[model samples]
Target: MQTIYIDADACPVKIEAERVATRLGVRMVLVSNGGIRPSDNPLVESVYVASGPDEADKYIAEACGPGDVVVTGDIPLAAKCVAAGAKVVKHNGEELHERNIGNVLATRDLMQDLRSADPFRQGGGRPFSKTDRSRFSEVLDRLVRQAKR
Candidate 1:
């Protein structure tokens, strides 16, 4: 059966993903490093990994496979999931398929390089907006339905 694995550390659409998964009768696993409260919903399982970098990401990557959907903002993890044949979505609902994964990965690496090279290069990303959340919900809903089939 298809499952939705969420890299929940910095994800903003946890609740939205849960709602969609519950409605679609799909299983959703929220993997974190222990700060998130476990959900009471039986369909929603919270897997708290050891406190370390990429522990949750490793777990999710190992478990996810074809027909599985993963939600994450980490570009490396997204690429891993995609290579494993799972469909991946960003927090803002951007789908990262095989066709775009390479470009996305390269861009992310480039951006990281720029940041490291320029310590004074200020400016965090924009705050997540309602429209972004709405788009995520819609895209997640569609992906979940497709995975079910």
Candidate 2:
């Protein structure tokens, strides 16, 4: 049984994720640090971890294993999930597999280093768009179908 684990701390696609998981009949777990509302859907549940920076990430990683799907924007968490044989999808709907995890992690580290070096540096990432939601919906549907196989 493949489950969907979401890093809900800073994720912007919770509603979309819930809708997809419900439609796909996959159990969805939203892990957070107590900031998110509890879901009423029996298939969707929210797991609030202890208040810590990486507690939510740790819980998500520990709960997922092979054949599971994880949605997260955290590059390190995505890399860890991929290494654990779980499929990872970014909030932007990009899939991260073994082939590209290294490059993603490297780029994330490089950006972190740059930010640390220049305190004034800021991330240039744009706000999530409707296109992103559409892409995510399509990719998530595909992934759910694949997981059922």
Candidate 3:
């Protein structure tokens, strides 16, 4: 059966993903290092990993396989999930598959390099908007439906 694995640290669409998973009858796993409330819903499973960098990512990457869907903004985790044959979606609703994972990983590495080389060059991405939430919901719904079949 297909499952939805969410890298839940700082994830904005947790509720949305849960709703979709519940509606679609697919299991949704929210992996975090703690601080997230465990859901009462039977369809949702909240996994708390040890408090350390990438612990949740490691869990998701190792558990997910073909027909599974992963939701994360971490480019490296997304690349790993994609390589493991799972479908990956960014927080902003972008899909990262085998065809584009390399480019996305490269761009992320380039940005990290630029940031480290220039400490003063510090600026984060735009704030999450309602439109992004809507897009994510739609895309996630579509992906889950596809995974079910």
Shift of residue 30 alpha carbon in model 1, Å: 0.7
Clashing residue pairs in candidate 1, if any?
none
- Model 1 TM-score, all chains together: 0.96
Clashes of each: 0, 0, 0
lDDT per residue for candidate 1 within 41-106, as digits (tens), equals 999999999999899999999999999999999999999999999999999989999999999999
The local distance difference test score of each candidate is 0.93, 0.88, 0.92
Estimate, for each residue in 93-114, the C-alpha lDDT of model 3 and write its tens digit: 9888999999989998999999
Show model 2 residue runs off by greater than 4 Å.
Answer: none
Task: Give the better candidate number (1 or 3) by TM-score.
Answer: 3
Lowest lDDT sum, 10 consecutive residues, model 3, at 140-149
Q: In terms of lDDT, which candidate is stronger, 1 or 2?
A: 1
**Ranking of models by TM-score:** 3, 1, 2
How does residue 18 of candidate 2 score in lDDT?
A: 89
Better of 2 and 3 by lDDT: 3
TM-score of each: 0.96, 0.95, 0.97
